[model samples]
Target: MKTFDHLSVIGLREWIGLPELGIDRVRAKVDSGAKTSALHASDIVTFYRDGETWVRFKAHTGTRRHPRDVECEARLVSFRRVRSSNGQLQERHVIRTDLVLGDQRWPVDFTLTCRESMRYRVLLGCSAMLDGQLVINPGQRFVQGFPQTDRTLRG
Candidate 1:
């Protein structure tokens, strides 16, 4: 077995468990083609929370129903127009938060968007995969499953 001091530039797409958020087996795509990571969300509404910039959006954590729509909020850090895979540029709201992957955890900037068509719910891009923090195993799936704890900490 080989031990890695730092993640290789290839394994960023492997399955990551966000146990703190009760998200398990979320298939993410590591895309160097994008500048900001994207999470599948719906019914996105921007609002003010505690007199601070915030946004409320729905998230699906690879489940059928029950607690399907998750309302998440984060400080409005910035918004930028990013070109999509199909060459259609769209403006997206970016938020910074802590992401846990395998034995590694770090702050990541995620762009909020309605990704109803994309196969994978989460798209980990270059901006998030920087600093050799992740190693994507293209031939692997669910490197680790998230714990079944509904610790929904608001971002």
Candidate 2:
């Protein structure tokens, strides 16, 4: 995508995957209104490594009966105090990683949180869209096409 030249049109919802983070088929809701992206992560643990903070979390993707477990570890980028759609405030762990959508892979910074209550497992917000690099077609779904399962599993 050309920065400031053209915007990549995407649909309302897309199946995005983070292969490096050991997550595949993360059903994400694309929201241009939201400022930052968030992922549904459980059993979050934080630790220090050589004076830098690192995180370890488990991602359970897919349905309850067909669930898949993926263990992920990433360097902690920041801690963000975010307000939810329902006007609830919480501090969340922020991490930077690459996300694959369609045929493109790009770095995205996202907050780690428990989004189990939400319909989608992930939320792709405006900030991660790179300030107008993406245009959302609210009426459509999977404009970039479905996810290709080419990733090898990691623990």
Candidate 3:
């Protein structure tokens, strides 16, 4: 396989974390075609805090089958109308948080929604890929390796 030494080559799926959001291990479907990543959030509620918007939600942080829920709170980035895979438009609460993937780390925005029926709780969309830094191998997984630590050492 051709290599781009500067790029982190990942698989169709990988494990990532959102420690800032209290999600230690979330299986993410790396979907390049998706514009904005999504999080499997339930019981979402909006509230005001220090003149800023905040949201409280429960998300599945572990595997789909052996799921573990994390109660999370984050500053609301915005409220957006997002189109679902089935082409239905829905209003969603968006929040920004740190994404821990393998040896690298970055901040990403996630649209909150109930993804109980989906295979994965998180969807790593192109926006979160951060300027084409990811090269996906369609047949592989954990290309960056499952983060050995619940939270990565990387900043």
Among these predictions, the greatest lDDT belongs to 3
Across 8-122, the per-residue lDDT of candidate 2 in tens digits comes to 7789999888877877667789988889999888889999999999999987666555666688899999999999888899999999988888767788988998776777778
**Which residue pairs in candidate 3 collide?**
none
Q: Give me the runs in candidate 3 sitting further than 4 Å from their true place.
A: 1-3, 148-155
Which number leads on TM-score?
3
RMSD of 2: 3.8
TM-scores, one per candidate: 0.75, 0.86, 0.89
lDDT for each residue of candidate 1 in 1-155, tens digit (9 for 90 to 100)? 99776664345445654443345446677787777888777777788878888777777756343335566766778898988777898999887766766545667877877666666778888777784365556675555444222342233
When 1 and 2 are scored with lDDT, the better candidate is 2
Q: Which portions of model 1 show Cα errors greater than 4 Å?
A: 1-4, 8-12, 17-25, 63-67, 144-155
List runs of model 2 lying over 4 Å from the truth: 1-5, 148-155
